[model samples]
Target: MDVPFGKPPVERADAARNREALLCTARAMIAELGTEKVTMDGLAERAGLGKGTVFRRFGTRAGIFRALLDAEEQRFQAAVLSGAPPLGPGADPVDRLIAYGRERTHFLLARQDIARAAVERKGPVPAGGPVFTQPHIGMLLKQARLGLPDPETLAFQLTSALEGPPLVFLSMDRSTAEQRAERCQGDLGALLADSWQTLIERLAGR
Candidate 1:
C-alpha cells in the first residue's frame, strides 16, 4: 500500500520535547506567580524558546491554563469515579453528593486564583457540563426512584447549588471557608431530607 505524502507527518520527537518544555515552564510560572502573571513572553523567555514558538504551541495564555486545568480536572474526576468512599462508590448516593460538595467547595477555594483565571477566560469546569455532576445527580435521583416531576431538571438545580462561584461569593460576608462548608453541608442535609419526605408523600398518593 502507498501513503499520500500530502498529509502532514507525525510530530517529531524534538517538537514533542519543545511542547513539554513549554508546558512545564508555564506550570512552574503559574505556581510561582499565579495565572495572571504567566504570560506568553514570560513562558518563552523561561523555556528558552521564541515567543512565536510559545504562541504556536498554545495559541494564547488562556489556552495554556485550559490545558493545565484539563489535567487537574481529570485527576479530580478519577478520584470521584474510583478513589474512595463517599466521593467514590462505596457510600449511599446522597452521602456521596454531600462529600462531593464538601470536597469541591474546598478545591475551588484553594485554587481560587486559578479558578478566577479560568472563569475570566470562560474555561469549563467538570461540574458545569452534562458529562459530569449533572448526569451523576440525575442518575442518583432515578436510582432513588424519587417521585419528582422532573428528575433531570431537579438534578441541574442540585448541581448548580454545588457550584463554586456562588458558594465562594456567599461566603464573603465574614464567613470562613470552614464555616461555609459546614453551613452548606447542613443546608444540603435539610434540603434532601425535606425533598425525600415530599417524594414519599407524592408516591403514597399514587
Candidate 2:
C-alpha cells in the first residue's frame, strides 16, 4: 500500500538519533556564531560525523537553516490559528490583523539574520507562501467581508508594505525591535483607518 505523500515512513531509530544530535549541535553553533558563520564542515566536525553524514541529513547549510526556520514558522502560525485573542481566533479580524502586524514585526526582527541567509540561498522567506502568514492575513480580509474582489491581493499589498524595504531600512535607524513593532501597529492602524469601520461591520454581521 502506498502511504500518502504527506505522511512519511517512520525513520529508523539510529537515524532519528543522529538527526536530533545534528540539529541540537547546529542550533548551539547558530546561537554562538550566527547563521552565516555556521558552516557545514564545522557542524560535521562538532557532531563527530563524516561530512557526508551532514550532507545526507540536511543537504546544505541552507537546508538546515530552512528546517530550523520552518519549525519556528510553525509556532508562529499556530499562535495565529488558535493561541489567543487578537493574534488568534477570539478577536475581530481587524484587531487580529493589527495584532498580526505587531507580532510579525517582532518575529521578523528576531529572525532577520536567518531570513537574510534564506534570501542568500534563494530559499523561502517568511512572507510569500500560504504556509507563511500572508494567507492568514488574506483570510482575515475575507472575514471582514469587504466586498473586495481580490482580498488576497490586498493582503499582499498590506504585508508587503509593512514588511518591505522600509522596515528593513528602518532597522538601521537605532530603534529597538520593540519600538519598530509599535511603529508597525501605529502605521497599519493609520493606513487602514478609512476602511476600519467597514471591517468592523463585516465582523459584526457574523
Candidate 3:
C-alpha cells in the first residue's frame, strides 16, 4: 500500500475518530443508495456530524469518494503485496503481470461510479490507480527477462495501457462509464485480460 506521495499531516485524535466514523457511514450510504445519492448533507445527517466538519475533512462531495478510493487502494495493494501468488508473489513475473491486469481491470471497472464521482468539476481528473502501478509494472517487466530494447519504456507503455484507458472511460458521458463498466464486469473484463495475456505471451515469445 503506497501512501499518497508522502505522509499526511497528523490528525488530532478527535479528527481521526471523525474521519473513521464518516468513512464508515459513507460506505454504508453508497452501498445502500449508490454514488449519486450520497451527498455531503446526507452523509453528515446520517453520521450525526456537522456539515462543516464533513466539508473540512473531505473538502468536497467528490473528496469523500476520493478518500474512500484511497482506502480501497491501500487494501488492494496490501493483497498484492502479501496475500497470494500471481497477484501477490511467488509466481512468475509474467504471470503476475497478467493477473494484475485482469484483477486491476475488475477493480477499476467495478468502482467506475465512485472513481468518476471523485473527479472535481474544476480539478484535474484523478488517475484510477495507486502510485505503485508504474514502478511495480516496471519491476515485473525486468524480472520477466524479455529481450526488449527498452523494457523501461515498455513498462510505462504497458502501465498506461492497463491503467489509463479504463480511467478515460471512467470520466466519460455522465454515467455511461458506470453503466457500461457494470456490464463489463463479466465479458469485457475477460476480453481485456485475455488481450493483456496475449500481449505478454507474444512479448515473452511463448
What's the lDDT for candidate 3?
0.85
**TM-scores for all predictions:** 0.64, 0.66, 0.86
Give the residue spans of candidate 2 off by over 4 A.
1-17, 120-131, 145-150, 166-206
Candidate 3 ranges beyond 4 A from true positions: 1-11, 128-130, 178-186
For residue 137, model 1's alpha carbon misses the true position, in angstroms, by: 1.6
Model 1 CA lDDT for position 51: 92
Residue 36 local lDDT, model 3: 94
RMSD of each: 6.7, 6.6, 5.8
Residue ranges of candidate 1 with Cα displaced over 4 Å? 1-20, 119-131, 145-149, 164-206
Say which candidate scores most in lDDT. 3
Query: Over the stretch 9-68, how does candidate 2's per-residue lDDT look in tens digits?
Result: 355667878887987888899899988688889999999999999999788777777666
Per-residue alpha-carbon lDDT of candidate 3 for residues 27-135, written as tens digits (9 for 90 to 100)? 9999999999999999999999889999999999999999999999999999888979889999999899888888887887677788878988877888646468888
* Per-prediction backbone clash count: 0, 0, 0
Comparing 1 with 3 on lDDT, the higher-scoring candidate is 3
Among all windows of 10 consecutive residues in model 2, the one with the lowest summed lDDT is: 120-129
